[model samples]
Target: MAASKKTLEQRGFHIEVLNLINPLESMSYNLLQLIKDAYKQGDTATAQTLCNTLSYSLYYNPNVKDPFWNNSAMSLCNALILAVIDKCIEEKTEDKICMYTVANMLSELGSKEIVIDKQGNTKNVLDIYFEILPADSVAKMQYATSNFAKGGTTRGGIFSTTMSKLSIFTFEGIAKMTSRNSINLKRIGFGKSIQGKGTPRVRVQIIFPDGSKESIKTDTEGRFELNFKQKVKKGQRIHVMESETKKKMIVEVQTINKDTGETTYKVVEKQDGLQIENIVIFEKPIAVFMIVPDYDSSNHVIASIFIRQLYFVLSKYAGLARGGKCHREVVFLLDEFGNMPPIDDMGNIVTVCLGRNIRFNLIVQALPQLKMKYGDASTTIQDNCGNQIYIQSGNKETAKEISEKLGNQTINSLSRSGKGLSIDKSKTEGIDTKPLLTPTELMRFQEGESAVIRFMKRRDNKFEKIEPFPILNRGKTVMKYRWEYLGDDFDTDQSILDIDIRSLHEYVNPRDLIIDFFPKQEEESFEQPEESNVFVSEPKPVPIPSEEDPEEPQFADIDEDIEIPEEAYASEPVSVYESEPASPFEPLTLENWKHKTAEEFFETHRSIWNIIEKQCMRQWNKSLADIQASTMETFIDELKILVTTGEIDKNIYRLINGKYGEVMDSLLEKEGVKEEV
Candidate 1:
């Protein structure tokens, strides 16, 4: 029942001309029948109208072959059809009327005003003119060549301008506007050039957008100025006219338009202003000088450390001071000393950082490497900063080499005579340096003690404390140790005469008290416990066998009193004493107390224990015995066990010992024990 109802609904919908098959066939048949009827009646207007209407429908209907065609097609068809009809009318009216109408339209178009819409379609009076202009060949060429000439005409006259006049005005306006925008007003200044000793002269002018001009003459000082003015607007011109040459120069100016988001700039160049005279260029490139010593055989580690330190130092100083944009301070640490590779890492730093206005100083113990490294030691230190100092090296060989290379003052003996700190003022040549001594603070230096100090006053070169600068261990030189091990022995006051204490020139391995002294103290047993007494006295008697009878008769034997010397007689009564004491008293002697009981001994022990406890508390708030025992066992025993068992790396252990060795030594010494190796 549902299917039947749906089918009936479909049939109802089909009732609306669903039987109209083949739309094109139907249309063609209908059109032919209409034409036939019109022809049969001989109604020409009806036939024509019917044919036009049919053609129009064919062009418009989307279902037809030329569907979707709009006004362009309609207008084209109308134009052609109108032309055909006009031709027919001309034929009928003798063609004179057509020619007259065309001529009149052309004349009207030339005088009309015109406006073009956004789509390039002309509006206003010009749109009307376009309706009559002839589309023939002869009229177009003649009119196009000379639009403003007599008898000229156009499709749009209201907004259309004369071709010749338009071309001239557009070109002039564009050129003038471009020139005005390109001038840099802020950088503009007037100056003159001088040839020989004669007074310099140049002409200057300022041209404004309103065609007004101002002129100025440079005086003997060769300077002239155009006072500051309000910013010129876009399209405004600034022309500089030379009074001497009567030449004109266009200045460029630029303006930004926020409304239209456009930048209008005028660009112009003059060949005369391009010829600038009296420009000077310096003859030298900016350079920096650095120094490293030949005796510095430490493989450049020290040099690297020093250079890195100096880099940061100079960077910080440069940051604080101004007007040093072109100035640099170069430090030569490693390969810069002498005849080595020029492009070494050390030299690279100098090349990279130094430029003109830069000041530099280099240090090297010997001239050999410098001659070897730099290819020319004589000229190595020669530059804007020609100053060099020959410091006392480790030996005479080193010192002599440097002195000869620098050609500076040579003091014979730096160590023996201690004339190491000498200055040569005459050797400076073009360079200037005062006898600037190293600051007392910096020169109070020991060997290996060096610092690149910027003398407060000196500008050309830096001052460096030279090596054997005395690693002063009691004012004597220490045998130079391996550079790698130098750091390990640092601060040990190793008898190295002048090694620098302040420098991180070499790796310092921390001193280990355990390795050097712990064992020695242990072997000596430096701390021994003091003897103590914790005992009390007690009365006691010895048993002996009876000599006379089983029951020994104990009697006090009476004896007659004998006269005694007065010297022996006492002031009081002298009583007879028995073997055992009558009173409760004992002799205070080890011999007499040898028979003391266990209880007495225990009381003595308690007394001594209390005294020890109180004394320990008074000092360390801990039992001395306990503290000493615990610290020794934990640090030595546990550490030794861990080390022996391979649980702890020796370096780590050594590091700890190095750091706390002094603390450990002091503690043991306080406990009456000298530190042992």
Candidate 2:
């Protein structure tokens, strides 16, 4: 018996044995009391021996009739144990846990017996199977079984019987199939009650799980429905409240069962009490409308998540449409569209959604912003749009393109041009064509102006032809309706128009809305320390320098006759002063200097003459004296060097004219320079 129990444990049959033995132990309370008494009397050895004896007896002999006990308990246990051992071996061989092994375990534990109402037929034992099987496998199984049950082929029938014996178990499946009739009835009841309405005489009240109630009135046709934006849990009640009139009705609704694919509804009538209705079950693509501001950055990431989810839903609907199962259209109105992450398979959807009755209304700030976010894909998306409307745009490129699309128009042109003396004028008028609205005109359009471009689809042609037109005040009248609804009351101190616009720094606080996903850097405060009240004696003032102090002079006195070297005069006279070669170098009279050019006058100055002479000798192997001797020509040569070297500036001539008027007059006279030509 000990060896057999060990073998059972090794084969995983110990659980079954424990299940059977646990009941026996509870029933044998007197034996347990005797063992406890022995242990309490300080005879632990005897108590342990008694416990061992009880364990041995339970393991060796399970109390039941011969073959019945062996087959139902021992044999079943052995089979289960062997199956587990085989599964473990299979797991080791595969290097992973086989899903079938888990299914087999559930089959053994969760199997149920179903009695077929046929004489001489054996009872069907169905093993509950797991639902982790591939979708194709489940589909194939469902198809084959459904076909076979209708008395098809022998092999198919056998397969069907086998499938019936093992069900792919899901709680939702039972609810979906068994409660279809009830759901249909509820759908009918709700449909009838709401069929005709004008502000429903009856009020429908919905009582949610949290004990909160919402009341709603039916429309003119008596049709009313409530759409819950938030999640609804199971067991929530929805019923119609009492009304004053005899037309009072009660409505009872079941909470929606998402898993079972059930929708909740309620129906009520004056004669009939509140009746809970089961909503019709069918698959339709869910419509989503998202509005996001283009300027909002804080919620961009969150909005991206919504866009991705929307794409996923659309993709699923597309699949359904392909299978000919989709019955309704799915439309997405995405505003500020360019700010979100790229939608997966956007190109494919743009091409395919039209056929599938799925529409995407993408509202973007500008085409460029869209192109920036989606790259070349933006062009493909734009091409797919059947109609495009362009509102007044600050963007020049967009406005220009829009204007050009409006096309050209013919007009008359006239030209006339001549001068007074010639008087040779001819008037010519001819017909010419030009753009109806130029780019500049489009750019200067008012705020409410717009242009429209539409692509008209032809059945015979694969490509669409674009037609463009201009629209003035593109829906500005809608604002009047909005004002009518909101009321125009601007007489308030806190009116938005009265507020002054300032820089972001004035309104934005650094501490507010700080998103700290990671550790933040600490910043030192810039507040200054307070000044001390204690006074200190002032230091003695420094004395200003006086003539008596005798410091070096900052400005030296100029001499009346500063000696300039004779080498400063040129050896050969330059052409500018060649006509007056005998011109005196000093004490120049107005007659001799009057003809001198401004350049000659500049070169005669001491500071400018020295700079020019040095540079000429360095660069051209020519000095002021070598170029011209005792003539205004030498000054002219030096002036050329100064101008060529960019050493003579306008300011130098102005200074010379201001401080050395007489010297300038003498040089001007030598070169025959005059105040005016």
- Give me the runs in candidate 1 sitting further than 4 Å from their true place: 1-365, 373-396, 400-448, 451-677
Candidate 1: C-alpha lDDT: 0.31
Model 2 RMSD vs true structure: 46.7
Worst lDDT run of 10 residues, candidate 2, spans 532-541
> Roughly what TM-score does model 2 have, to 2 decimal places?
0.30
Winning candidate number (TM-score)? 2
| Tens digit of per-residue lDDT, candidate 1, span 1-677 | 11122233343311001001111111111112233234334554544454343323223322234322232232322232233223323334222122112222323333443222334343323233223336652222223322332222322321132221112112221112111111111111111111111123765555666766555555455444443222455566566566666655564446644322234444474544322122111111111112233553322222232233334334433443333322322333333433332222333334434532233455555645444443442343333223334334454544443333333323333222223475522322243332223333233435543322221323324565433221223233333445545444333443223321121112211110001111211112122212111111110111112244233212122123532232211122211123434533332232322343312222212232332243222322334354333432232333333333334444333323322333323323444543223
lDDT score, candidate 2: 0.38
Mark the 10 consecutive residues where model 1 has the least summed lDDT: 509-518
Q: What lDDT does each candidate get? A: 0.31, 0.38
Number of clashing pairs per prediction, in order: 70, 37
Give the TM-score (vs. native) of candidate 1.
Answer: 0.17
> Candidate 2: which stretches are off by over 4 Å?
1-299, 322-326, 417-425, 431-433, 457-470, 474-481, 485-677
